[model samples]
Target: MTGSGTPPTTIPGSDARSNGLPEAAPNPGQRVLVAGGGGYIGCILTRCLLDRGYRVRVLDRLYWGEEVLGHVIDEIELVQADVRDFPGSALEDVDAVINLSGLSNDPTAEYSPEANWQMNAVATENMADACVARGIDRFVFASSCSLYDGLPAGMHDEPPQSSRAAPTPPPSTTASSTCSRWRAIPSARCRCATAPCTAGRRACATTSW
Candidate 1:
């Protein structure tokens, strides 16, 4: 069982030939670019990725303080940039992209709906497009459980209907959009996994072409 306490379950549709997420271990030294690496989830993921022997680069606007990433500062490269304006040059040579950029939590989204849509929705699609354009095959989108809101306790295990996509809440339009983009990519392999939610835990879906 993972730290989440739920016995681990294989996320539907995961394929090792695609994004490499399901691989027992990713090859050492493969470079992965993490957008929004300054945030809480990103900070934790960055360290873990490093420990697994992958090279990491972070692109963030630093909406939060940088102190969380300080411990790994020298080990990884940091690019101060927003997901909306991320440069293609940065994607050069990157083997994969992990997108964590977005308006986190309901309060922040409520405070600025337009900004939330732009950052969470618009920018997420942009990242997928950019990755495709640059020939980056792997993408992992860190999405929130806000999508699962109102789901009945037992219904959480229910499969998506017809659409073949995960059921998401209205608040997570961004995640839905990102999943749409992955679906549009015919060569991409996609998987939706429900991670155990802790006090502030986040979950992600992985895709690859």
Candidate 2:
């Protein structure tokens, strides 16, 4: 991972000023807590935030390795821990949280569906509750387009009408349900990025709920 001193124009779908939060003004002084910031996508995102002048703290299990963030290791605060049992102190000074802390693909989920459900669904709800209790309003969840897997071809672009209509795999479905349930929290500004990412191309649809 590489670190830069420039900040990005904005965080996707965040409106810090709207909910009585601090004015972003490009967020130079804001600190973002990125859960799972050592993974493939998370590493890239962590570097981007650092580039944009935001202070970043990464909470990750680092099940793979930390070499992915070697280049910028000195620039971030790294916490080696699982999200499921993360301490409340992780949210203490955090202004916003971007959760990318679950199993990334089908094979991993299939290997242990129990683990998948706990990480993708239950852990997410627990974190969101913690954020709310701490008065942290901004939460960005990295969801998957796989939630639309069983939809008819024509309906792929549309949000699933109901859980029954989607019939996605257990992991993806439960993750999606977690996103929906948190959308109703008045103080939480929940944004879901449904990504259909590939080695050659990455496409994401960001929706605020």
Candidate 3:
């Protein structure tokens, strides 16, 4: 969608290191398809990408409204669609993909487990498959530290030894864990970033495979 406004000159949390991307950054101007690019985290992330000179294509259902991206509406390509039912054509001309689409919080997941699974797990798998089919090599899936929620409070960043002993986790945690397993895809260089709670701008520990 095109808008008349200019892109915002400054975004509060636009620092590169704090965005949780890997040390090896993509070259500027590569088109990055950001699924769920209208949500809270996605809005900030889309802006950062634009500021860094990457062309962004946002594919979002806009459940929270498109106003979040109002400033940059004209600066990038915006595709309004659900990630679960995303069209194959949407991936055309995209150099890479950053999947941020999912039921983000526990309350939303608890309210509807089926939708959560579809959005977080099934959609992620489908997106990865789509990327592979199109020969897109770099796929970044936004996972969560919630997978370790079953562990002790201070044990989130620790190894998963304790997490294995935890009881069956909720849908949100399971979905995030499922997405993390995408690193096993042989044809793609997948990176899963275990995102921490967002306060302001912060760095996340990423495990690449």
Candidate 4:
């Protein structure tokens, strides 16, 4: 085992007495933090994650509802907190973050687009940044299709030549531009899934979840 020649061999599944391949240990919580866990979707998500053996934490303003989470209060970590003031320390060991706190496409954005932008767009962008900075790469954003203002002008049934509007792959960068670049955190594994409609989750729960 000379340094210049080859490193010492490591036995599979052995301790220091032989070679230091570690013994199997239970998963390290595989922690997940749901940003709005008191809401309808958040509560259900927490339970679903918990049932799958992932450790879960709930950080919510709880302005809408908390009763949905009452039964599982004992099994989870609850923080009545806002995304703007998310405590960075708690995220240190977390594996993923699913942010659901935002003003849904409600009429209130008209009163103050500034506030809405701050919470919905800016805060979410910053949340991604924070997660990357802290090595939590997996981030799932609860955004809406409302942002997709433009679509392919031609229906799928129509031939390409019949299309009135030109389509050129839409710049080949929508997802990366909006989300994937932030997943570069080397230590943190990442995924950004736009949660489907509320019904999607419910349906998943019925069959696969």
Candidate 5:
């Protein structure tokens, strides 16, 4: 899951901001901060932002090799900082924050539950607080729809509830528990999606398979 944030500015050729997200290009020169911008999804998103004329700054620990960004490393302002230890000052002059920093998968989270909690839950909360304190209101929290696998087969389309509306097939794991909590954070903007993408993942899967 990867979260992206942008101020209320209109993008060219789209009415994307009608959903409380600020327009992506109401005006040019808006600066965006991509936390964990070196990861798989972050790398692609950063490239898109640059192509769209936004100034991008990426903060990533680069646990993955830097090769994903080799072509664009020179094009972006890269900062090597762990999400848990990042400072608010880094967000200065930033118009929005997209938090993609966290353990990327279930095996990693299951292996190191403590670190997972800190990175996925604790660090996320800290980042949201810092963004709010710094007056950066646009926060997009990317969350997995895999958690929805827990839902009953027939209830997938039900209106979302503040609590679990159906019995889950399996007991919750550390990641799901923490994600449920993160979903409830009043300060952060969470996009509760069930894919690795917004719309394209499912479309591509159906077409390819």
Candidate 6:
């Protein structure tokens, strides 16, 4: 308390600063977290980020061949941790996050539905919450399109994108579609690169979700 009766505060660096919450902005160049940086597309993204001079930190279980990023190992920081158990410290001082971890697709998913849900669905939701708590900026996500399953026999194939050439949903039955059809492959892994919550950090996503 102040001598007169008011609470007292001081500067941070120069002998006295208020709690020091905003003394200066953080330097953003240090590092970025690529959650699934070892996956197919993630490998490319990791290289691109490294080429630009940002410190790259890759968090992956190496579910696939680790060689995917062999060419650039020296230039990146690798973390072998599953997103489901992602350490809170992993989000610290991170400029961005590109989430590419998840159960891949149908065949693999059927192998173990419980595992898929635990690794893909649950982990993603938690990661979103963690990022919010951290102050990290930006996320690029890649999600599977399986969630859009239509009623049994109630839905038809989506129309092509090239034919429409406009912002309109294709008619219920367009013979051919400009848009490419998505297929579920055997691999079952989380591909949610960037989720909606990341957008608050001006995140960029590559997934369909």
Residues 1-209 of candidate 1: C-alpha lDDT, one tens digit per residue = 35676777776435444333544454679998888888878898789789878899999998776787898999998998877787777787898887777777767776987777777777877777777776676776655444544454443332322232433333345565666557676876442222323111223222311
- 3 or 5, greater by TM-score: 3
Better model by TM-score: candidate 4 vs candidate 6: 4
User: Which portions of model 5 show Cα errors greater than 4 Å?
Assistant: 1-24, 149-209
List model 6 lDDT by residue over 28-136, tens digit each: 3668788888976678878866765668889988887678879888888888888778888787677666666766554565587666666666665566556645644
Number of the top TM-score candidate: 3
Model 2 segments more than 4 A misplaced: 1-25, 145-155, 160-169, 187-209
lDDT, residue 140, candidate 5: 54
Ranking by lDDT: 3, 2, 1, 5, 4, 6
Candidate 3 residue-wise lDDT, 1-209, digit = tens: 33569664664335534555555545887899999889878888889788778899999999988888998999989999998898888898988788888877666766887887788878888887787778886677665434444455442333343345434454445544654576665655554444334311122434211
lDDT, candidate 2, 1-209, per-residue tens: 23497666664335633433343335676888999899878898888778767899999999989898897799999999998787788887988888888887766776987887788777878887787777776777666444544445452333453334323455555665676676776656654444433210122323111
**lDDT computed for candidate 3:** 0.69
Q: What local lDDT score does residue 70 receive in model 3, on the 0 to 100 scale? A: 97
Give stretches of model 3 more than 4 Å off: 1-26, 144-155, 158-182, 189-209
Clashes, model 5: 8
lDDT values, one for every candidate: 0.66, 0.69, 0.69, 0.60, 0.61, 0.54
List the candidate numbers ranked by TM-score, top first. 3, 2, 1, 5, 4, 6
Give candidate 6 regions above 4 Å deviation.
Answer: 1-30, 145-209
TM-score, prediction 5:
0.64
**Cα TM-score of candidate 6:** 0.56
lDDT over C-alpha atoms for residue 141 of model 1: 64
**lDDT over C-alpha atoms for residue 51 of model 6:** 60
